[model samples]
Target: MGRKLLSLLLFASLATATPAAAAPTAAPQPPTELVTGLSLPWATSFLPDGQSALMTERNSFRVSRVTLDGTRTTVGTVPNSVTTNGEGGLMGIAVSPTWNGTSDQAVYLFHTSTDGGQTQNRVVRMDFDGTTLSNRTVIVSGIRSNTFHNGGQLKFGPDGFLYAGTGDAQDTSTSQNDSSLNGKILRFTTSGQPAPGNPFGTLVYSKGHRNPQGLAWDSAGRMWSAELGDTQFDELNLIVSGHNYGWPICQGSCSTPGMDNPKRTWTTAEASPSSLAIVDDTAYVAALRGQRLWRVELNGENAGATQAYFTNTFGRLRSIVQVPGASAIWISTSNTNGDKLLRSVIQ
Candidate 1:
């Protein structure tokens, strides 16, 4: 063969042998408004049916059922709930995975309440008969509450147990205290007992969290959390049973002997990440102060580069949940002035 022909053939062979770099994940399409005029909405939990979701309004203490078709109905108001006027009030809600609206109609809520003139955070269970909420039962209590750092996001893990993310309640000491429920991610059974094989013998699943607000499980069942740092950085942590995520010790990444560093970190100004949802291989985080939706590509246990969407467009994004049985996500705005719940198509 001629020299030019041989060189061209060698170049083509090398190109075919090299694997192509993966294409970057596309940003979510512009969101469509699903429900409007919400008041500081916080968390969203889709019912088993996937037709609607239960949402909480922070200051209103009202629980509402929001359908995908833009209809909103007040299911019931959580009695005895109080807001700290900052981050407290009716915060997180999770529907029982086994809920049938008949035999097992259990819905869980986390809220701040006043007890004997002291404010505290607690998780309660109620019966939802598909119309109204009733039978309020306090499952877990005595979590410290403050005006600022009251972490309240509840989710059912892939293991069928409930998990709670709590803040340090403005007291940094609680983050390292295993006996304290504040500043920790808690795992428990439906009936309010510590889950089997919990890292500690108590409800504490992991310790040393400053203000963890978001929890999600990747396709491999590994848990991930989004946390608000004090001033320097925000964190996306790979949560492990009993691992201490450096909090007062380290805000984002650290070299402490026994502490776990975050998989990714963003400046506090870039991400006050609240709720997290994993769709396919991407982890979507809703930012409160950042006023955007962050798409973090997940590569196994590690998080890749991030992309922000809807910055300053929808105001402060708070709650985000992957639409059940669909390739979409429902994210809510937290701006107190006529907030809205939006649905965005995940590419």
Candidate 2:
């Protein structure tokens, strides 16, 4: 990598006025490993104080705590979770925006569970007492699940509502069905009811997702999602209420009526995106199969040219969370023996 910066200009349309220009920022420092020996850690939710973080491990159902100095401990476990090989078990986790570790100390989780022995994915909330978990509550249930395509990504949007991305349980038809909870982004109140002002009067916020895994709201409050396509193109979509994302009908972009196109896309081999984090107006996506981190600069809702780092240096990047109060991000790798937590500086 060169230290010299190159100026890049982008325009939305040919008829647009003088284009806005963005110069290449300085290359970031190589990531520093924070912890090791994690078993398929899926998502990372940082504590507001920034000294520690929570990590969820798939197939293990254990929530581990990672401190700034690389200490690790099993803080809690999601009970009744059913493990799956390809894509199941405990998945996304989030810290409640209002949690203060005292009166409202709560953490949220998304996992595949067989509470009824019928097999399904569900969302639950657990009380985090800063060292261990207690007081489990099933907030949402009955979302479809399968060995694959069980999209599990959770985050609280700027509106303070919990938003989750769910898969169609390998049933492509469900992506287009409004009545189905699968293949949709769901919005709910803090207690897990359908949020007010929902476009469909239900939990479904948007539809037509083929294993969408990543969600982040930009600085302007616009929501964005990173979607997985079947053996073709993966997409970064601008999510809006009640919009259809064209899953089975269209892979990338299409002119089909009543279907929305992606703002950007990448080949499946290059970017099987899993989790997204935004910092300094740039969206950083963690890729599982692609084994890299992708940075896409955001100009309002539009995405600029894409850049990738640590292409094969790290094996199967899974989750990334921006460290609060700093220009650094905590990252997790997916390789079995090689799984480790890393901190990469943002530049």
Question: Which candidate leads in lDDT?
Answer: 1
- In candidate 2, the residue pairs with backbone N, CA or C atoms under 3 Å apart (3 or more residues apart, or in different chains) clash, namely none
* Model 1 lDDT per residue over 171-238, tens place: 99999999999999999999889999998899999999999999999989999999999999999999
Q: What TM-score would you give candidate 2 relative to the actual structure?
A: 0.92
Model 2 stretches astray by more than 4 angstroms: 1-26
Tens-place lDDT per residue, model 2, 264-298, is 89999999999898888789999988999998988
Clashes counted in candidate 2 amount to 0
lDDT of model 2, residue 238: 94
Please identify model 1 stretches exceeding 4 Å from their true place: 1-24
Q: lDDT per model, in order?
A: 0.92, 0.88
Error of 2 at 256 (Å): 0.9
